[model samples]
Target: MRAVTANALCAGQTRPGSGGRTRVLRLLLTLCALTALFAPATPARAADTTPAQAADTAPPSQAAYFADRLRENPVYVTDQLPREVPRATAPDFARIAKKTGVPTYVLVLPMQSSTGGKELLGAVHDRLGRDGLYVLIEGTDVAQATAYGVRAPADAAATVALYELPYDAGPLRSFERFAEVIAQGGEKAADRAEAARAKSEDDEPAEMYIGPSDRSNQSLLTGTLLTGVPLLIMLSAGYVRRRRRRSGAERRLPRWVVPGTAALTATAIALTAPVVFDQTRSSAARTPSPADLSARVERVAAGLKQDPVYADPESPRVLDARQVDRLHDRIRDFRRSDGGGPVYVSLVPQTPESESAGDPDLFAAAVHAKVGVDGVYVVADPADGTIDVYNHGLRLDSNHLFLDLPDSVAYGDSKADRADDHLLGERLDALMTFLDETPRTDRPGSESAPAPAPRAADEHTLPPLFATDFWPGLFVGAFLALLLSGIAAGLTWIVGALLRRRSATPQSPASAPASASASVSASNLRRTAHAELTSLIGEFTEPSNDEPDDHGEHGRAWDCLDAAMLLVEGDPGRTRERDTDPATLVTVIVLARAGRAALAGEATEQCCGVNPLHGPAVGRRHVRVSREGNRRRMLPVCDPCRDTAVAEPGGIPDRLLKLPGLESGGSRLPYYEATDGPLSAVPDGIARLIDKVRETAGVH
Candidate 1:
C-alpha cells in the first residue's frame, strides 16, 4: 500500500488540480476518519498506540478569535476519535471559572507529537484570549497541563506529576483532581500573600508626604561646595608647599597629574553630593495618603473611558497589529461578567512619556473608569520582560491585588531572552486568582485603595556591590582592574628603562657639527683609556715566555699576577674620579698596576713620564700639571716642593709640559694641546733639543 503522510493529506486538500493518486489518498483518508469515528479512545498512556494515533487530517484549530471562543463556555474539547467532549465537563469548566475566579480550559485528543501539541496549545491561547490553567489529555492520565495567560496557584505540570489515580480509574477522575488542585491552590496562595502584606504594614505609622525643597538643596550645595572646594585646594596646595620645603624636589607636579587628580576628586564629590543631601532631608511628609490618593484617582477618572487603552507611542501592541487584536479578543472574555458589572482591562507599556507607575496604577484606574466597576490594569515592558498588575474595586484592601513586576515570565535554556505565551498566560492566571480570592468590596472610585505605597524609591537603595554572599559584578570589575594595573606597571618600567638608556648614552646632535665632534672625541678618549688599562692588566696576568724581570716575577708568577689583578678590578675606586665612569675606571686600573710594579722594585713609568726624583723630571702628580695630592697620585710629592709650588704659584713648569691626553691652548681659555714629544717627558738631554726647536720655531 502506498502510505500517505498527514502533511501530504493536508496539502492535497488545500491545493487544487487533484490527480488520481490524490483521489485515492483522499478516499483512504476518509475511510480512516470513519474508522476513527467508531473506534474507542486510543490505548492507555502506557502503550504506544499507532495507526490509531496517526495525525488528525482535520485539525481542530483553536485559532479562532477570543470572542468566538467566549460564545461557548470558555472551554473547547475535540478529539481525533469521533467521541464528543463529555457534555458535562464544558459547562462545569465555565461554572468553576466564574465561581472561583480562575479560568479553566480542557482539551481531550490524540496528539501526533509534542511539537504538534505545543502548536495546538499556542493556537488555543491566542484564540481564547482569557488566561487559564489548561489540561491536555488523551487516553488515561494527564498528558500535559500548561497555564496560558494564567499562572494557576497549583502548578499544572507538577500537580499532574504527583497524581495518585490508579490505572483502573477513568482519566476524568485524575483530571478532576488536577482542576481542583489548580482552583484551590490558587486561592490559598492569594490568601497567604494578602495576609503577609497586611501583617507587615500593620506596624507602620501612617506615611507622611515629603517633597523636594529647593532652599535646602541650595544651602546644601553651597555648604558642600565650600567645604569640598577648600579641601581639594588644600590638598593640591599642600603638594606644592611640600615640594618647595624639600631641598631638591621638582617645582611642580607633571601637568597631567594635577588635572587628573582634580577631575577624579570632582567626580567623587559630584557622585556623592546629591545622595548626601537627599538623605539629610525627609520627604515622607510630602507623600500622598490614602484619602489624598483616592481623591487623585477621581480627578483622573474623567478621561478614563476616553481611551480604553492609553498606549504609549512605542507600545508593543501598536507595533504589532496582530498582537493588539489578540489582546482585544482575550480581554473580551473578561468583559463578560455575571452581573457585578463587566470588567475592563488596560494594557500599557513602560515608556518615557507614559506615567511612570502607569507603572500599574494609571491603567487600573483607567480601566475602572471606563468599566465603572471591577477592572484590571496591566503595565508591562516587553523589552525587559517585566509585568505588573493593578486591580481596582477588589472587595478587600486592593493593595494586595497589586503584583510587583517579575523579572522573567518565561525562561528557557541560556539562549532564551523573552517570555513565551505560556508565561503570559500564567501571569494572567495569577491576576485571576487574586481577583477570585477577594472580589471588589469598595467601588474604589475608579482605582484600587491606596496601594501600600509602592515601596519608597530611596528607602530601598541599590544593594552594595560587595555583598556578604557574592557579587559577580565586583569579581569581574576587580579582575579587569588588576589586569589593567599590571599592564600599566609593565609599560611604566619599559618606558623608564628606555629613558635611562637614552640619557646615560649622551646624544650627539646629528645636525650640529661641533656637538658631534665633541662627542666623537670623548668616545675616542674613553676607548684609548680602556685599551691601555686592558694591556696593563694583561701584562701582569699573562707571562712572557722569554724572560723574568728584576722583580723575579718570572715568565709566570700566577699567584702574584692573580692577586694584583683582583686588587685592581675590586678596588678600581681607589683612583677612578667617579668610581663609575668608564674612563676614570681604566685610569684606576693602570695606577694600580704601576703602583704594584713600583713596590716590586721595578722601574715604574709615570702616566705622564716625568719624575723630579730622577733629576729635573716633572716627577709626581702633586707638582706636575696633573696637580693631584700625594695620597691620590700614583707617585709621592716631596713636602718642600709642594710648599714652594703653593707659595710661589707659577703659570706652568717647562718640565711638566708632556702630560698624556693634555692639549695646549693657542688662544681659548686654558686651551692646551699635545706637544711633539713622545707622550712621555723628554729624556735627559732630549728636552734641550725640543726646546731649541721650539725657540727656533717661535713656539711658547
Candidate 2:
C-alpha cells in the first residue's frame, strides 16, 4: 500500500467545517501549553550557616599551601571543628583535578565568614587560570555542599550540575555524590577526547542526502495541496445528489468534528513543543579541544600568579574613563558591606612579552598579581569576549553574581560558548548587584551570639530558563497537561455518543408536541395567573396542609388559579367588540406573558386552531425557542393584537389563561406594567410562556 503524503493531510483539512475545527484546535492547544507552564515546581533552597568564625586573616604572601594541587596555595581549610576536612571527601577533590587536568581546590569549614566567597574564588581563579572546580563543604547543622568552576569536558560538566549536595555521600561520605559524578564524568571525557582525536585525521567527502536548491521539497507538498484539492472537489461535484433535499436530511458536519480537532491539535503540539522550548540556543566558547584550552588557561594563570607580574604592573584599563568613578564608588561600597576585598581592573595586550595570544586568562593573572588578593580584579584583552573576575580578602563568590550580572551586555551560555556573559561596564554593575544582594555578617568577635545566616532578598536565584530542573520540569508538565486534556475529551465523547443514540430512536407523533411544550409547566402558569387575579381583586386564599393529590405539593398552589382561569375564558364579558375579536383575546394573553418576560418556545402545532375551546381564524403556529442570549426571540408580530394590549388594563385577553403553564398565572404582572416597560426577568418556564401563548393565540 502507498503512504499518504503531507499534501493529502492538508487537503483533508479544506473540507466543510474545517475552519471552525481549526479554531477550536488552536484554542485547546494554547490552553494545554498554558497549563504546562504553571506545573508545580520546587525552587532551590539556600543552605543554613553557623556564625562567622575567626578566619585566616593573614596576608597572601605569608599564607601556607594546604596541598600540591595548586601552586598559588589558594585553598583554605578551617580547623574550627577540630577535623573539618573529611578524610574520604578530600580525596575526591584531588580526583576531580586529575580527571579534568585543571588544579582543583577545597574550602572545608564549619561556617561561612563575613568575607564573601566571590572575592576569594575570583582571586584563586585568576591565579589558577580557572584550573579546575572549587568545592566548599560546610558542616554546621547538616553537611551542605556548593561547587564552582569555569569549564570542564562535556562529560565532566554534566556530572557536577549539582544544585545542592547530598550529605557527604562521596569520599568518606563528604559530598560523596559529587565525587561519583566527577569519576563517571571523567571517564566519559577521556573516551570523548580519544574519539575526537581519531575523527580529526579522517578527511573524505561523503555522499549527501540533498544539496542546497532553489526548489524546496516542502514547497512541493504545499503546491500539491493548493491545486489538487480544488480539482478533486470539482470532479466529485456530480456525485452529489441534485435533489432540493436528500431524504429530508439536515446538513450537519457530525459530532466528531470538535473533539477530533482538539485531539489533532494537541498531538501536533506534543510533537513540536520540545523543539521550540526545550533547550536554550547557544554556542560554546571558541576553543580547539577542551583539554587544550584547560592547559592554556593554567599556563597563563601561573605567570599571573608570580609576585613580580602582580606588583609591577599598574594595569591600564580600556574602560571609558567617565564610568570608572562610578565603578570605583560601587566597589568601595562592596568592600564596606562585604568585609573588604582587593579590587582592581586591568586590560592586557596580547604580545609574547605580556599576556599570551590565543587565550585571555594570562591577562587576568597579570592584573591580579599586581593588585594583590585584598580586592576585586578584572583582567581582559580588549580583543577577546570575556573578562576574568578575581577577588581576595572579600568573602563573597560568583554564584550570587550571575543574576546581578548586567543584562545590557550581550552574553552567552559560557558552558558552551566560553564567551563572557557581561561587558566590562555590565560587569561593573553586576559587582554592585552582588554586594547589594549578599548577606552582611557582623565582625568575628560576636562568637557568643548565634550567627544569623545573611538574609538576601533575591540572593542566589536560578533563572527558570537555565534552571537545573527546567528540562525535567517540561516533560513532567507536558505529561500532566496531556493527561487532563485526554480525560476531558473522553467525557465529551461519551456524552455525545449517548445523545446521538437517543436522537436516532424514532420520536412518536403523539408525544412530539407534548415534548415541545415541556418548557412551561402547568403549575407555573396556574399559580402565576391566580396570583395576578387575586392581586387585581385585592383578596387572598391560602391552601391547607390536607393530603391533597392534584400533581403533588406544588399542585395545591395552582388549584385556585385553575378555577380563576376557567371563569375568565368562559365568560370574557359577552359583547361584539370584545367577544368577536379573538385577536384582542390573544393580544391580551400575549401581553400578560410578554410583560412578565415569560417565553421559551411555542407549541409545534397550532393548539388554538385544533382545540374546540379556541376562537376561530387563528391559523399558523410559529415557535419561540428559549432566548439563548442575544438571539432574536420568536415574538408574535400581529399589530392588531398588540394594539389591544396597548389600550389598558381592561384590554388584556382572557384567552391567555387557558394555555398550559399560563392558566394559573393571570396577565396582571404584565397587566399594570406598560407595554414599553423593560422586558421582565421571569423564570425560564415563564419566559417561554409568552412566546407559546403569542404563537398559539396570534397564529396568522
Compared with the true structure, all predictions reach lDDT values of 0.40, 0.35
lDDT of 1 by residue, 206-256 (tens): 222222344344444534443355344545465444433321222334556
Q: Mind giving the per-residue lDDT tens digits that candidate 2 earns over 248-339? A: 11222344554455456545544544443432211111112223323323443444454211211111223443344456677666656646
- Please, what's the RMSD in Å of model 2? 35.6
TM-score of 2: 0.21
Candidate 1 versus the native: TM-score?
0.23
Q: Top TM-score: which candidate number?
A: 1
Error of 2 at 193 (Å): 43
